[model samples]
Target: MNRENVLVIGGAAGIGKQIVLDFAGRGKKVAVADINKKALDQLINESGRPNDIFSFEVDVSNWESVQNMMTKVKETLNSIDIFVYSAGITKQVSFLNIDWASWKKTIAVNLHGLFFSTKAVLPLMKNKNGGSIIIIGSGSAITGSGGGIHYAASKGGAFGFMRSLVGELGKEGININVIAPRVIESDMLDRLYPSEGSKNTLKKEIPIGRLGKPSDISNLTNFLSNEESAYIHGQIIIADGGRTFRPKSG
Candidate 1:
């Protein structure tokens, strides 16, 4: 069996890291592109699959950086079968408190990064047997909750960007989808619920009774990247243990 070649952007830490390790564990040749050189080194050195997992430094928000990374990917992996865009940052602030820098940074990494990555990878994917392009999005896009205004706006922009790509890419055999995971035991969750009491309270709101494990997301991501989810494209699947709800926001 020929293992798939996976390129996970922002895959050095958190949920992205989990996806990288999961694919590597499955014997797939995985390449992780991240801006954090420190985390990338730690991930590869500590992952116990150093040879199977390749690392590249990239600023997803920079088109030149993304293009350079793609060049490295093509040279190393030869071709990409799975392209996962998991790059994002969050800053919790009231709409009034939002600053231009914060909003711009959020949009650059979370939203514009998508434009850079998918645009760079499409040529590679289009030449192949129709690969899967998965974006690790946030449920905040739907509920307007958790993350601040800028975070919500960025994710919402990703939704719009992805929706536009579906029609253009789907017929070309490239499957595009967004996985919006919430309350996962990740750095993002840690940022949202820093204290144990807060986390516990948040957990109580979930129908599943606990915070989600990264594996929960990795399992679904693995499915989406494979043949099993071929028909599931151009959709944002929220995996939050049914935790999202609001009674008219009043």
Candidate 2:
């Protein structure tokens, strides 16, 4: 069996890191791209520096950087069988306080990054005749928050973008989908909820009564990236531990 090649953007930590680890454990050749060189190095080290796992530093908000990173991925892996766009940024600033620069940066990393990364990998997948592209979105896109307007907008755009791409790429044997996870126990979550008690308090509102884990997202991603999920495309799978379904009064 030929080993599958995977490219994961924003793969240095959190859900992205889990996805990379999962793929590597499955004997797949994995290339991780991220803006944080230190995080990338830590990921490589934590993974025991496997020969099948490679890392690259990239700023997904920049098209030229994305192109350069993709070129490196192609050179290292030869071809990409799975592409995962997990690069994103968010701030807790209120809508009224959002500056033009902050808004643009959020959109650039969350929305434009998705577009750039996907565009960069399409040809490689098309050439292979079949591939999977999974975008890591946020449940906040569906249920908007007052402080994260820019984040919500960017993620909402991701949904629309992937849905539109379905018509364009599905026929070419390339599958695209978005996975939106909420309140996952990651560094991002830590930033959002500084106090440990605050994290626990938020969990009470969730139907599952626990914060989502990186494995929760990574397991679903693994399934979606394989042949088993061939029939699933242009869909948004929300992995929020039933948080979205809970009633306000519950």
Q: If scored against the real structure, what TM-score would every candidate get? A: 0.96, 0.96
**Candidate 2, pairs of clashing residues:** none
Candidate 1 has its poorest 10 consecutive residues by lDDT at: 241-250
lDDT of each: 0.89, 0.90
Instruction: Evaluate residue 52 in candidate 1 and report its C-alpha lDDT on the 0 to 100 scale.
Output: 93
Per-model clash counts, in order, read 0, 0
lDDT (tens digit, per residue) of candidate 2 on 92-191 = 8888899999999999999999889988988778778688999999999999952489999999999999999998888888889999999998888888
**True lDDT of residue 220, candidate 2:** 98
Q: So what's the TM-score on candidate 1?
A: 0.96
